[model samples]
Target: METKEENFPNDSTMESIKSLTEKDAKTFLNLIYALIKDNENPSEQLISNVLTIFEKQLPRVAKARQNKN
Candidate 1:
């Protein structure tokens, strides 16, 4: 069975993050902050899923930023 990380496209590039724009990034950050600040009790499965997404995707974003400097 394919995992969510495997199912997610590996074709993300710097262009994608760049396209997120300041406003979009701010909105996304706000949403994440709200979720964290609210003390929402996420299920283990939900936390696992989100962590998987972050592990798979955030490195690319970080790498892209690193390369930009």
Candidate 2:
């Protein structure tokens, strides 16, 4: 399997990760854990659910960053 470094060809992704707040980082980790919890590939429904969550979160994240600026 390709490692994360191999998956991301540039350092910008790592830099963005470093900028994440602790809570945001934990939320991402939790999402990853949830996806891999069963030690098997996540089901399509679960992927759909996660994508829905991201869809809901993106605006909130953008709003929060806008507020910070």
In model 1, which runs have C-alpha deviations exceeding 4 angstroms? 1-15, 43-69
Estimate candidate 1's alpha-carbon lDDT, on a 0 to 1 scale. 0.57
| Model 2 ranges with Cα > 4 A deviation | 1-5, 38-67
**lDDT per prediction?**
0.57, 0.59
Q: Estimate, for each residue in 1-69, the C-alpha lDDT of model 1 and write its tens digit.
A: 768766453555434455555765675566556656765576655556555445555556556656776
How would you encode candidate 2's per-residue C-alpha lDDT over 1-69 as one tens digit per residue? Answer: 758655332454444455567887788769767776854545766766655545455446545755797
Every candidate's CA RMSD = 8.1, 5.8
Error of 2 at 17 (Å): 0.4
- State, as a TM-score between 0 and 1, how close model 1 is to the true structure: 0.42
Worst window of 10 by summed lDDT in candidate 1: 7-16
N/CA/C clash count, model 1:
0
